[model samples]
Target: MDVSMARILVLTALAFAISGWAAEEKPMLFSPVSEEPEWRLLDSGQGRFTRQEFENRLGKIFDPTGAMQPYLLFDDGGVTLFRDKARTRPLYRLTFVPEGGAGEVNPPLLGGGDPARPLAGKVICLDPGHIGGDWADIEERTFRIGNDAPVVEGELNLRTSRRLAQTLEASGAKVVWTHDGFEPTTTLRPADLYPEAISYLLQGSLGARLPKYSANRLIRWNAELLFYRSAEIQARARRVNEELRPDLTLCIHYNAAPWPGGRVRLTSANGLVVFAHGSYTAEELAFDDQKFHLLRKLLENSTPVELGVGQAIGEQFQKQWGFRPENYEGSGYSHASGAGPYVWYRNLIANRMFDGPVVFVEGPYMNDRNIYPWIQAGEYEGVRVFAGKSRGNLFREYANQVAAGVIDYFRRQAESSATFTNYSP
Candidate 1:
């Protein structure tokens, strides 16, 4: 063979050899493809998973065009994945011990595993309030008490969380949740604020390290896994974003008040209102402002209530519902102007501690007699009707308006963060 031909053949063989070696060196947990497309479950925790299983999972998760799938996976421990643009970002890594196993299974490092690693991409944390049991306890069993009111708040929160998660996931965003369905509380109180509380919760031992506190000490204290045993939730959220620092953190929740006769309303007010914590700093205030802008827009679109009409609605509820709107102060009907436990809790944790933009939606009211029935029925579509009849749905046209606002915020963040080269179409 000619000298040039021989050299070209040798170079081609060397390239193939390097490619083979690189493939062999890569961790087995990650797909062979570097494009990192969205993956779907083929068998779903079924039979022995081999290379074929992996391929099938990939096929199911992705389309024939080989696009990344938007989905999340969580075992008993904390393990999450966000598939997009042919790459998977690890949200959290867990060491799982199989039943009767001698040792644990350490998730192989694929994208990244360090807890302090920057988030690979954007993340959405959905905090679904209450639980299914909360609904049964109130609606079915008729167990009414302090703080434990009805499960309506929890149910609505969970439903909306699920919907939002599904929507965001489809859009290629990593999503995690604080609670799925009333799991055992594993949160711990912080040692600094309540050393005794933390010690007591951990049985005199530090089960987990706490996140560093910034200006919001109450947020830090409340963030403890012990106070409400929400530490595990916080840890999971932190772990997933460790390597792939999320671009945003969203806490989904419904509003509630103590009054019995108020109707639904929206709020434009913004500030830090921590439930576990008492106050906030300038930075926290800025974050809350961004979140308020996002949430106010979202609620205006989702809820039938009209913007700048809370006072009008309050007046109408008193006249028509015959119950004082003031009485419904804590039942998810009042705006930010009114004080309630739910408001305090939502304002504190969601707005203060999260580094990214955060916001909470007071889904719907459960205390107002006219609104409570629809909520119990899980009939959000009926909300538009109620809003229209009551002049609250006049804001429906603003749905696109609010959605546009969120899109603009995200576009700005993307431009600044450079996290995604392009927004998902």
Candidate 2:
């Protein structure tokens, strides 16, 4: 067979492999397109915590719903974190220190930078979410009203990141980008992902969604989702974790609400919410990758830093934009961190995959009647009047608040002699 024909045959076999019909089962059991985790990497966390600390942290920040209980076996000596409820696969053995005993913890946000340049030695990685340019339509992050310029979320994110990076670098911080331009970080196109998408679909059932769309259309839709969401973010995560390895990573995004009647018009639902990577759902905790990341983030001691920075940005948002907190009261995937209106804890692909502290900021709702024109106005040179106050264009304002919050947090760190603390009885 020719190379093209052989490649098709391989993919056809792979589809069966994904469906579990093939003799050799794929190694990845959870989180499609994810590699099977090397469970040994969590070895360092042994004896790094106390039983109280472990339970407290989980109750407070990571798993509030007791989703992790099944996977953890607690005893006087330690807690054995398992890969499954059956406990056949052991992931880590964490020993508890005695009460008031010294548990090894890397203090978060030690105040050491030059007072003026609070971020002097810090490395910040900025991720402008989604691929715009020609990829905008495919990403589904672009929308428009009757005869108006398209409001593309990726465009807004890139603009905001550029301005934020400028401010951060001026404060003596080095700023890196996951991708500076619109091109995708992953080489895999939608066509290349068809087999995996097919496999993903087949997992649901042989009768999975051929009703809504034909087999080809359903496969195409799944291929696009995997391409944009799973594959795309995974590519960015590889860069953030492996290559950049910065002190902190910021994922910038613009929020949107469903337009009334599903029309492409504006609404009055603008608000703000920032995420600091916790709150793994019960369903999510069952996945191996989710469990691995939950512990990894906990072990890194990023909570205080994430909360501090998140609160700072939130303050800036209130002061500058005067928007109310974006409510996630009914949203099962997220919960308030008790830090402030703007800060919430939620597990997300970028935040979960990145190694260090991750601050995911979702700015003004795109479909807000009040903000739609501001978006249509695009990035302009001077302030524009919205709600009877002069405001920088949406891009600059978004960037400024984010940068200010970051700067404020670091400056507070620089002045204080104390390590950030989130532990409370």
Candidate 3:
């Protein structure tokens, strides 16, 4: 068989394997064999999904003959079964929710509900790129930038996602972040701090001054490490989205690529390139298109960053941040397509695993050395100025514009769907 045909067959088999598992048996529920597991309730004010309720549902779905095991009920309503002592193999996840239940609730618009009535619920999963320990692992810390240079993309992505999460939460969205820091924590660590620390230590040494070569090399090494880590982080984010079943999944990252003359350039300009899963069902695709248009309007109104700025920022960031844009074959925004590399092959995984609309945002690149201090300091206000003098009040301005756009999108969708539902020839 031809190489392409063989690859196609393998993919076909994998799909079958996944679907077969899903169809063979209902998700099983095993009682805590050891000690009674503590159940945590995720109450988002809009509604609540408790572990008990999830287990109860699972019990109903599981086949009577099936064995039970420890399982995880993710905040976004995804349930995973752990059969073996090890949690390596992920059993089937519960994808569908019965109508009119908490799981089926939609996000409410601002001021659309009475104080007494619960607001609409929406789940937003943020995947920050890179793990904290990525630099330490040489094997996992290497990745290509643009086409050649190696750089670390994970660290920058994680930091930006952390900031975005804070902004989204403050805007009344239920935000769940995957891989907080190197370890599992609520706080996000600065991506550039580790390299900066090395630089600091090197600067303190007299030998470092004699040869700038070693210092420059170290910087370049760290950047490559960041890219490898970012890839892992993106994978984890996809897993989390699968388990959580959020309303939207946003993978946040900074872009990097080589300059025309093989030199590096830094930039402060903000660009928003939204990505949707290309293999989505028609219904999901329609929803994504609506979201893409709305996001475009929101971003265009907020910053000078345009749709095709992914490559520009990617190249600029590599020169500035020492990393490269993520290399996903399916990324919609490729140079060949003039769309830029916003979409990725794994994005299909995220979309398939997730039950709702999903998007990836390659926010402003962090290579703009002029704004590095502000970003490192968590001074978003200063960062906004660095983006543009006209871009005042970073979070507030961003929140207002995005919120307005999202609200408008949903309202239109709901209205159109309602009209269609009521229509009769």
Candidate 4:
């Protein structure tokens, strides 16, 4: 054989060996089924923002704690992200738009219709929290006060979403649902997640890490938690990011205070809060999936939209329920959104996983002594006296305010579309 041919053969063999080594040494990811970050997915954002714009966003919304500093290297033209704090392995390089320059033109707006339909051509995805029917007990989202009827949060969320969907559709927005009924979005049951649960337990990062049961029972218990909390949400995220691809996604949930000493009971505490993603703890930033998402959300320009819709929703809550914001002041995982007292920035799993803007609404406190009676009354018609004031059923009231808030946001977006340009999105 010729020397040139021999050299080419040797180079080809070396390339294959390197490829095999890289493929076999897969990085540890958050979920057992989670695919590694597809770095190239962010290519659309190339030259979409300036360094100043990126830095302002990072300081104002994402990465407030500067946890990303360890993994990121920035230059005049772009940034390089690494998988580890030592920055030995590079993940992706993102170029910035030159200062005082315009980015590539964004795609045309989706809807141009009659003034009457402000939401025309908008796609909204509504997620009704959890599985409430047969799985409520397993999911532990149901509670009972004495002989009174059980208050199931998942069921409540579904009821609220159905109403909200109708309201949004009436305004000319196309509505999609993550799950319409009690069925879980995920097919993986607790048994299927046992191994993942074991791996999670070994990390000792999840809740219930301390021994609360026998070794076998502890692992089994965590498996159940993983199934509902992680796997189920991941499934819904797949739908949101791929199939639904909604302009905005809403995660509707009813809040409950911690049941102390494993005793489920009512409390005097009551509060309301709206969430838009932000506030990454150091621990969360350590993972590559989290690092990827933080950048994706930043470059997607979801924070502005998230905050805008969140503010409108906060107003509705004040006008309707008059509840104070749930104070997360000392909570390490949350930060004040600066939009209002009722809206805060929190990095929740659903918000992190789903692409685009997300508005997470935490409804009334089900465990509040005042709310327990309202819940017991069930999803009834018209108004009834509650806490010395006539009020609509809790579900109806929740739905109305949420629907109103969404409509308000879209109306404003429509009015401002002529002037507003989202360079990153």
Candidate 5:
């Protein structure tokens, strides 16, 4: 057999084995076995949110009546999240809910398209993580000096996304963006949804950032507005599911460590961490739609491909930039899919809510002594040499690597499915 042909056969067999394994397994539960900072299991003693906390937060985004009371219920003797509702089926059990709402775009079958433009006819969505620009501070995605220009993550990621879009479009792939610019896609800003949004902050880990209980209402409220992270992300999820139905979604972000005192400072950490949807917390599992989403994720056999794309991107990053995969000692960094060291299975909002496979790319730590300067260097035209290599501007370099990964992944998929005109497997 030909060399590529043999590789294709091996990959196909592996995919089949994976799909079969997914079919055979029972619904797995999330139980954090370690106290590592990354080992997070919702309400599993170390989770970021408790049952009450989750209920309140979920309510702010999904329910309001207190009617859906404890919309989420934990069996650890915690109270229910929403009120009892009349239903055809029970609310909290592990039953599969058929996917509804907007239609989804699955991976396109290859073969009839131009081999040069391997991504022809594919719809890809590039979601630059936060609502940036003027809203950067509001989104908590900016690092800055007192009065000088801020290093806005949203702006940088958007630039990278636009560059990636150009590459994809040049290769005959149509790309959609979750947000065109800094402005959010949500119907209402956090200011409009103030109290509820504030309630969430005051109740969760971010609460520490709030003023003391005795602080004046106006002062506390202003502080709460700074942490509108969840609401904004949920808005993006709504857009991903309802509007931009792409074959795949890439959530772009520049990584950063927990800034001490919520202030950005120079840090030694610098690495790439990519997430491709696994690690479903028990809180997420309790929801019918989430359960269905998890089931579909496993059955679609997309995780392997997601990992493949992630690995491809990681390799390109390493080759072009001196970036390395993030490896930490915890379940946060665990659940490796065997496709690559950088790829992980984190149950983030984008990973859980997007209709199709989501590859969350957490780029290099923005505060790294070596990396921070590049972020501040802004954009430039044509090629520039950095770290002993010639490449496009920083954003372009990032975009090129990601675009190369997507192209490579589809090329392999196309070659593997050479026998069929519309084979998704």
Candidate 6:
């Protein structure tokens, strides 16, 4: 053969060898094609999740905090796959797909039902955000403005939880409480967890370790975690994963905007947001088990379910309190599951550790100029001039909204025949 022809033949053979080697080394996660960029089978569906679906439903498709290794790309050939487009030669593979064929259908949202008794035969867990009442100061949930009954997020959230439980029970749903009152549920006391807490406070700096007697941010942070932070999170997660294996968990918390200049003033910002998992971080992926767990969650097709439920609850919030859905500006905050507008992706411990579905609810800013007075007014039942109808007063309205949301979620699930097992990781 001619010299040029021989060189061309050699190059073609080399290309085939490289492609074959890549296919052997890095197997596809879901696709059947050989070394082709195709969709990762997150869930068994007729087609892959389209980019339009990601943009219109979830606002964004990529995780900003980490590499977009798993890009959901679709083609005209009815093939879908998650590809790590960052690499010089991307790897697309199929890792998981459900047994059933109808995996692409979105979980249904809560619909209208009986007012007196809506949720029946549903098991719900109400996780009040923080230890409230006497421990409000300890949890750092107290915001005092001239000492007028300090705005306590824990107390407000607890009140909301209690009322929500009552409403749920009245409607015939079994309710589990992560925290009954101000008492913490953590197995280890703050002092017992002091060593680990101190390590975290020191931020992994061996030389920067604070003396036990030193009064510094490290010391303060250590104390805070012991009382109601890292340790507290562990305790709460234990309740959800072990003790209370309810169908779903509602993590209730009142939000507060940061005040610049170290000053605390009431702002007019009033709105609401809710979250469900699905933005796995690099830190979480470092652990082998958690990495597997995160992958399982994604593969099991739970994101759509969580987003659907989150959006259902968001709708109820809008209806009852006129709260607007949140639109964040950053990475995880902006990414969603194409199920709802308000359902943003976050890597919270509760969202990460809890085995079951968790809905993290962030209500109106407690210190909003309009909301401050309602917060201080104390709990009451019946309508008032400013607050309107009071089921158990204005604070209870938080519970009312939540209860309504949960009921709405279940009601829709029942209507759509979406079982919990379908989305369980």
Listed per candidate, the RMSD to the true structure in angstroms reads 24.4, 5.0, 17.2, 9.5, 17.5, 13.8
Indicate whether candidate 2 or candidate 5 has the larger TM-score: 2
* Candidate 2 weakest lDDT stretch, 10 residues: 202-211
Residue-pair clashes, model 5: 10
Q: Please report, in order, the local distance difference test score of every candidate based on alpha carbons.
A: 0.35, 0.82, 0.39, 0.82, 0.61, 0.61
Each candidate's clash count:
48, 1, 23, 0, 10, 16
lDDT by residue (tens digit), candidate 6, 1-425? 24553454456447657767353454332111112222342344334434333333322322445533334443433323332343233323332223333334353333234434557656788888988777677676878898697788888888888888898898778899888887877765555654445334333322234444433444455556555765676667777867888767788898987675569888767877788776655444333333334443443444555676688877777777776676774553345555556678776666655656778888878887777787777875565655443333566777777777777766665654433435443
Decreasing TM-score order of the candidates = 2, 4, 6, 5, 3, 1
Off by over 4 Å in 1: 1-121, 130-150, 185-244, 259-347, 379-384, 387-405, 412-425
Query: Can you write out model 1's per-residue Cα lDDT over 267-301, one digit (the tens) per residue?
Result: 22211121211122222222213223222222112
TM-scores of the models, in the given order? Answer: 0.36, 0.90, 0.39, 0.89, 0.67, 0.69
Put down candidate 2 lDDT per residue, 1-425, tens digits, no spaces. Answer: 24553454467668666867753333324445776776677767777787777788888889878889999998878888777789877777777787678775555663567668889989999999999999999888999888998999998999999999999999989999999999999999999987787666645522333336555666688788888888889899899888999988899999999878978777889889999989888777767777888888887778888999999999999998879997777697788998899899998888888888899999998889888888888889888798787978888889988999999999888766434335443
For model 5, name the residue pairs that clash.
68-82, 68-83, 69-81, 69-82, 69-83, 70-80, 70-81, 70-82, 71-81, 71-82
- lDDT tens per residue, model 3, 310-373: 2333333344333334453343222221334432312233333333444445544444444343
Residue 248's lDDT in candidate 3: 56
Q: What are the runs in model 6 whose C-alpha is more than 4 Å off?
A: 1-118, 201-217, 282-293, 331-334, 387-392, 418-425
In Å, residue 330's CA in model 4 sits off its true spot by 2.9
